[model samples]
Target: MQLDHVTLVTHDLEGTCRFFRDIVGLDDGPRPLFRVDGHWLYANGRPVIHLVDATGPARLSGGSSALVAPRIDHVAFRVAPGVEWRALVERLAAHRVPYQLTEVPASAEVQLFVALAPGVVVEFVTSLPVGAAA
Candidate 1:
């Protein structure tokens, strides 16, 4: 099955949206009416990131504590090489977001990691053409 989307419960909803929009190149788009406040971030016309407002009085069912940070290591997105990859890296740098870059061993793929929030990190991966520099 293909991945649908990722949900983030955050007290800093606007800040998180800014990070996704300005840094990750996602657009803040339409979201259906729900009890709580939030935003849906879309990429390529698909809502890939869902943000939930943790500071709101409304609580989700199942008694899940939004204050407790998720244990996810990182969310990864495969990006196009060359211009797309370079532009993403440039945006991260321009925004002063700290990121680590590394290449896969014996492969043409490179990965960049950025800590998006407490206990939340995002990874961008791209495969470079043979003999092309990252």
Candidate 2:
């Protein structure tokens, strides 16, 4: 089955959106009328990342990203083979966002790691042919 979406529990909703928009190159997209604050980040006309504000009425209280450990270490997205991986890397560098790259074992995917927030890490992976890195 194809991956649908990755949801993040965040206290800084707007900052999270900016990170994905500016660094990840995702654009703001439509989201259903849920009784919460969040943003739908779209790529190729599909919502890939969903950010939900877990902040309480205080909005700055001990909640979500703040009051608990990050539930997920990272969320990964598959990039097409033709994507400009170099340019993407440069964009991240330009923003001073820390990231690392490594090859996936037994697969041709190259994984990129970036800490999106205090407790959030996001990954972008480029799919390669079998033995491509060999």
| Residue pairs whose backbone atoms clash in candidate 1 | none
**Cα miss at 31, model 1 (Å)?**
0.4
Once fitted onto the true fold, the runs of candidate 1 whose alpha carbons sit more than 4 angstroms away are: 56-70, 130-132
Task: Score candidate 2 by lDDT.
Answer: 0.81
For residues 16-67, could you state the per-residue lDDT of candidate 1 as single tens digits?
9999999889999999999989999999999999999886444445777554
Residue by residue across 82-114, what tens digits does model 2's lDDT show? Answer: 557766777888989888888898877888888
Using Cα atoms with residue i matched to residue i, what is each candidate's TM-score against the true structure? 0.85, 0.76
Maximum-lDDT candidate: 1
List the pairs of residues colliding in candidate 2.
none
Output candidate 2 Cα RMSD: 4.9
